[model samples]
Target chain A: MYRMASIIKTESLVKDFDGLRAVDNLNLEVEERTIFGFLGPNGAGKTTTINILCTLLRPTSGRAFINGYDCVKDAHRVRSSIGIVFQDTTLDKDLTAYENLLFHAYLYGLKREESKKRIEELLQFMDLYDRKDEPVKRFSGGMKRRLEVARGLMHYPKVLFLDEPTLGLDPQSRAGLWEHIVRLPESHNVTVFMTTHYMDEAEVCNRMAIIDHGRIIAEGTPEELKRMVGGDVVYLRAKDNKMAKEILKERIIADIEERNGEIFVHGVKGDVCIPEIIRILGEQVLSVRLQRPTLNDVFLKLTGRQIREGSPEDEFKESIRSYRRRFDRT
Target chain B: MIELKVVYVIVMRELIKFFREKSKLVSTMARPLIWLFFVGMGMSRLVPQDITGTDYMRFLFPGIIGMTILFSAIFSSISIIWDKEFGFLKEILVAPVSRFSIVLGKALSGTLLSSLQAMLIMIVSPLIGIYPEMGQIAGSVLVIIVLSFCISALGIIIASFYESLESFSMIMNFIVMPMFFLSGAMYPLKKLPLVLKYAATLNPLTYGIDGLRHILIPHGMLDFPFYLDIFVLLSTSAVFLFLSTYVFERGK
Candidate 1:
């Protein structure tokens, strides 16, 4: 139902390193001029997929095409169509921001005059014009990241691949990055493909794929995925949850779960089911609440675990997960 | 995709980076200078003129020049690991340019840097009482380029597989040290054990040192035909260049 020209398409792509498969039978399509997110925790093959599409890493089997160019056979054409910002910051710390941009422009074979004009315009757009002459080593983490993203656009690539672009940045900086990300499609005709474990960050994507253990567990627009989790969450804090849950099970035609002394009634059969729930609970119902489903709930329903706490993962990753949890709730 | 402009742009980055690290440049120049002056002068009084023709310093001068180019070529390539550690390799790898061009640019810049350092040794050779003829000076430039290209190609090949500077540096020492010593840099490839002589011949730097020796001084090793030396050096350059390019293009 989501229709736009397909900019990226992969067919049963598999990537194996040694005895392990980093990506397994991945088949995905990214529409043109939209922000597509690969939402997953660390070591879930998010970065591997991006690397294959960018032609930086070869898939063990199957094929990936970017803008109609095969990643293996037509790698050169695929490369020309896309730009990338690595998960780690890659700016030359010794070089000034302007010099870094100039060097990138040269590597991309941009004409001198055109690069100069574009460099000025890009620096202004990134709000880095004032610090263009200063060495990047002196820049803040957010500033360095912003500069790296700006450099990725030097060649005017049709598709931009960002691998955990805002990883390790503070919440404000991450939010600020989204602002630039949001402006990209408005200012330039380019599609954005990105990876993030943060649900809040994935909120920016027009469509997203939830990946786990080297496989795509679910794929759809954010709204569509959330819809899969059921429309509304009906929460009721009862004086006696055990008794209230049992009564709701028989009298209320809705799926119910209890957490922290509150009962959540999911997939309510109808709006009429809410009044029936309260009336059946009677004096045992202390309080009740209703809310829409979120992306995290969609991930939970598909993967059988939270995005951040699935298994042994990077500890710093856990920090970002907690940050997103608290920040998004606010 | 292997555009000359792309190669030039990469070479400039190498030059800019090399110039900024004044301490490294000093040490790079100093390491071989110590061997040329202290070791050459020390050996001059010990070895008779027949063993090394005129002065031992002159015989050792060409060898040191070979050493300079070889080490400069290999060490300059260690920066590739540095680039990887700093995460710049991802940017270079993901660029629209071909990996062959990227490797070409890396090797080209290493060649340029190593050749320039070899020139510094060339200039300093005269100050150490081994004056090169005008013809030898002109011809040595070609030798430096060839030797640099060959050895730099070797470094790139090693660098393509390793991501850490420490591991690559250790491996470089293990490989390059033997290649330097066994190439007749500190000794002659004359009548000796049959095995040692064959090993020296097999070493690529032997031809490079032998070529510089024939040009810089009259006491040149004519063990092989002059064309053989040129052919071997050119072939080594070609093989290593092709190999390095292939490895780099296939790399993840």
Candidate 2:
């Protein structure tokens, strides 16, 4: 978040893939030199919104501009001003990592000398210089992702679009990638527009928009979004939740969600209310817990459902991913 | 409106990939060679000599070249499917290059690649007691280039709708085999029944094979003039180039 003006702006953007409205009338503004995150679950129109901004897909109606160029009418100029790392692996598996960057550079018409210089710098920046000449098929998932990010920056575009860059990465790989991604604003001085289903990934962004069913449900800095949930989450198992929830609502003065004989209270300052809740419920409470608001909780509060299928279910996908990895390797 | 530099970049990228798959180059020629040597020798003894005014292998050489280019064009178009599945097509769409530039670049590269394979098959011409004049070889290459351009565009346009290699090849087999067979690659169109002759004439490949016959045969074996081959192949290529570009620009 530098003191730069908006580089990406959309007004009433809509996209209908056949009869399905993948993107509703979306309005968004992203400043230059900042990492903006589109946070959502699967099929939440994150990729659709990115496609519109990148000028890869024409919107059914409305308008989008990147770096002052209209996405539709100024498609060529808009493309010149932005680079993208597709969610799917787009590199030539048969070609070396260096060759992939080479083709990308030439496609943008970078001068030979300048292309060489930039490719080296980016490969080194991504810590992939040693493996530059090796075919991408042999690279690990993390290395391939790093190469994709580097490819997206070859043109030195004003904005870089990454659609789920770290989707199936291991935790360590994800952290390693974010170190490079989170540094782009300061190092490359480029605006980054990215989409992700991972909560912690969204928390790394300077600003975020939570989209669901082709519409933005919430948008702000991470802290602001968490604050929108109104306060801390306090859940308690009581000997009598029916009695305790009613009593806590009268005494504690906070919003309470009663589910399956458990009392989950919202908007209460945990330290202040925990003591009061303990004293009031005294012997009737089976267990009490106070936790800070997480982005998952924020989504849960807004949509009344988890942002993803929860971390455990994601771990299942993660296992299936390793199976895919083995299959791809063989 | 097309940027030549972008076109060159795409063609260079495709060629580099083309060269890496040593197996692909070998295999493209192998199928046609098997037909030229084994099937042609076997069929030459059975078919009457006066019917062709030369051996069946000599008459079949040009048709084999046509088949080689046709099959090679279809195989070359498989790269487009990989381009889609691997998401390279998305990368190009998001780049500064024009869609028509991409379409022309791919079509031209495919033409060159298939022509190169067709040229390798040309090396075996003397085995059939036919010595190709340099002029004849150059003329045949030109015809192959245009036919490759025409067929590649058709394959690319068909491949555009398919995301998977299996489905694309499956659909291609159903279409490509009929296009080859109906082109009279294995028989003389002049001897076919009236309905079959009409169907053969409808195939753009019929003119290309006819062109190869005119160029490669010493005795005049052409049913149509040499220029008509160039005219039909070139015009068909122009039309497909336009259609494929339009379909690609629609961005699926």
Candidate 3:
């Protein structure tokens, strides 16, 4: 028997809201000092699981532990051992950034001198030291988010949980936030547990679990999960499609299918297969292109549905519309 | 010790927010004065002096102070609903602190703010033709703190059942108006009909206002004895504090 060190562990965790199972019999183990991503679409039990682990929601059954403390029985110990950046903004917009951080420091029981020092250090690290005196209401979305990240780290917990840290940020801000998040583990010596629906964002994780319908469908490194879709996809248009299919079938031992006047060669190395297809159908080939399997393909292969169902631009616009609607209500 | 710090910081946060909203302080201070000058001056002429055993304006003084504590103390706990609406409650809930600390912090802040407002009203007691000795003023202030603590805990209990400002305000209007009218803050509790008198006796604020009258208007018409007023206020504060803390802890 072997034991792998895990900072966060859940065994057969289940949570039910009314009759609906929000988190269905789940087991998860996350190694220390690594970025662990829980990849899922909206309502896939991401936030529900995080809430349970953070001691805000009790599990319906089974158990979860953080830093060896039971989430339900030893809730205070679990809370002291973990930090969470909620999916929505939790900052007090009326308070200055420094005051907000100071408030959190006090709640976490940090001494005044130590809290002040760490507040300054974290403000600088998050690049908000210059604006620390300004009320958070005056900040842009990105600045508010960075301040929240700083506030979460004020107590120096062993694990930091970010629930969709960049859900509504612009492309530029999203990239900027990721830059800070990517360096957190190395600089702060804390394990990062984050959830995101963005497939590209999942690539940054050392290990990730693809969850859907309250169950983890796949779990591994990004590369390992993508490898589940097999080799690169080859899409080609030939002058004589039927003749090219016959010739390609006779020449190569690969699965070939024709759809909409193009032949897709599956389970073949694109670089090696592309040259051979060109030689075999020299005159019949009109255009040839190789498409590498992405996390989206892995999701599609596993669940027969697109992970993100929309382009990034479309998602951004939808988020903007919803933000505007919320703004109008307020 | 750490739990005490948690309570301190929570109170500090509310105080900082309270100071930042200068309008809130101005409005709370102004509300009691409006009732004193407008309503008190308007209604004093219609009532006979013997009914209250003093001039109507003097008789209304303690009630005005009770009104200050009632309004400010109850409204102060609305911060919980505001925190929930703004998502700040989650931050407080996720912190490694006991729910009792949070509830105590909220109740104490409300007590402090309302007591300060009531004392401000007391300082202007002369404007309403009521004069009190230093000991009477100090005793009244003690009564104000206890009453405010009780009302604030009651507010928290109501707040835990609500999640939105609209719903909270709707329910507050339903509860707060009746509480103030029935609290003997605007009338003599003894003169009410038997059923109404029983209703007033059950109100914690009635005992509080009666305590204030016992001190500030020593010769004026009084409802319960001085000891009974303090006894009721203190015991109600303890019960409310326990209930609010239990509700908060169980909410999660």
Candidate 4:
């Protein structure tokens, strides 16, 4: 059983805008100093949850706490504890990178000398020391993202919330940011709570919650989630191998899926299931291969749908439904 | 201490952006100067002296200063929507600072920019025939800064609920222009209709204009009390500051 050692916690938290609930009765426990990734399709209430925790958006009902401070009643304390990087790049285009950092430091109440030292150190860390005096409008997408991260860290917050931090960056920039994210926890002991749609980004999280329709369907380490789909995944290809999946499901309790003329089976002991699967298919088995289970599989098992095809309205409806479920459960 | 820092950061950002757009400042000042040169002189002859206790060019000075502050504050705040479009609001909101600080910072920056524009217009006002003594000039400048702060607060409140720059600009046109006309900027409040007179009483700019008039020509023929005018202006600014801060703290 997972212990409830949460730096931030929500219980039946709901956010209603007019009649619609953007975030339905959300109950989340983010552990301290962990790289907790929030995986959700767009409009799945990931941003809303972060807003509530950051004390930006007030919850319609229920309670949320950041480091044990109520999001509403103790909003000031909550804000002091958490730093957030929004989905859209927020650097002032007209200001130099150094100026932007200085401004943010001031907003966070850092003194001049300390802020200057931190800005210098952060610029060096981000490899942006030479570009510090350049206006952010002239910066590349990756450079802007790096400055934003450094700015967020200037306050030395207890928790950092990143909303789709690398959404529009290039592949190399995305990978580079991942490297920084990997070291964030170890360097600062600051809890990292982030949301991203990128599959590769989700894989590196210390723990992640796969959210769909405003509800957390699965929560675990990347390996643990993949294992939820079963330990090893086998891809069986045949000209007419329809019986392969049925045989495998009967022989071993495992998940079976088909895509592009291939049958995918997930099982705890894959090698043992393969022979039985082969025997059942007989001469029909053209080829068989084994590989790892992915977060995509976990998404598929929980939602009965792919994350990409999900519409905003569907997410809104799911959010409302989850709110009702939470209401009833409570 | 935190609020002051936030305000300073906001003001610095606003100033940097304003200075970067040299074209905007040039065009904005050019439009007012054209009016000061052409229409102000023509209107000075057409309009009577009883309306403002001086020539129309002199009357135009205070109105132009107030108008500059009004337009600057309103136009600059439309960037709140731009901030939303650019996603900067998220970064600011997520910072470990109070929302009041965010509102204060934005308002102070916009107000300071508008007040600076007003100051430039004041320097030019004398060339157009409205002269103030050095002592009066400082007090009038102080009043203009306060007026800008109050107007900027109104802008912040407007930006809080509106989502798009187009919509905000449209609303500003509808509200700001009418408020300018309805106030005694162009004519004395007493010369207008009773309905307008009462309405003008509510316009913070009315008191601002009155206060400027009092400070500029302290021994003038105006019947309105300077203390009352200053008090009303201060109170209106307080109301706006309080409301803007409240709406801002809510974070939309």
Name model 2 segments beyond 4 Å from true: A1-4, A232-290, A310-330
Q: How large is the interface RMSD of each prediction? A: 7.8, 5.8, 4.7, 6.1
Between prediction 1 and prediction 3, the one with superior TM-score is: 3
Instruction: Provide the RMSD of all predictions against the true structure, rounded to 1 decimal.
Output: 6.4, 6.6, 5.0, 5.6
* lDDT per residue as tens, model 3, B121-218: 88898776777888987888789888999999988888887767888667657888788889888888877999998998899999999999899888
- Report chain A TM-scores, every model: 0.80, 0.78, 0.81, 0.80
TM-score of each: 0.86, 0.86, 0.90, 0.84
Kindly report which residue pairs in candidate 1 clash with one another: none
Specify the highest-lDDT model's number: 3
lDDT of 1: 0.80
lDDT of 3 by residue, A1-330 (tens): 123489899999997765566678889999999999998766677888898899987888989988888999999998998988988888999999999999999999999999999999999999999999999999998888889888888898989999999989999989888999999989998999999989889999999998876789999999889879998889999998988898899999999999999999998888899999988888788999988888888888997878777544355334433432232111
Lowest summed lDDT over 10 consecutive residues: which window, candidate 3 chain A?
A: A321-330
Query: Residue by residue across B160-195, what tens digits does model 1's lDDT show?
Result: 777666786577578888888888787777854789
Q: Which of candidates 2 and 3 is the stronger one according to DockQ?
A: 3
A53 Cα displacement, candidate 4 (Å): 1.4
Candidate 4: stretches off by over 4 Å: A1-4, A18-22, A234-289, A310-330, B48-53, B217-223
How do the candidates score on chain B by TM-score?
0.93, 0.94, 0.96, 0.92
Better of 1 and 2 by DockQ: 2
Which residue pairs of candidate 2 clash? Answer: none
Off by over 4 Å in 3: A1-4, A234-265, A269-290, A310-330
lDDT of 1 by residue, A234-269 (tens): 888888888888888887666788888889888763
The superposed Cα distance between candidate 3 and the true structure at residue A323, in angstroms, equals 22
Q: Considering summed lDDT, which 10 consecutive residues are worst modelled in model 3 chain B?
A: B163-172
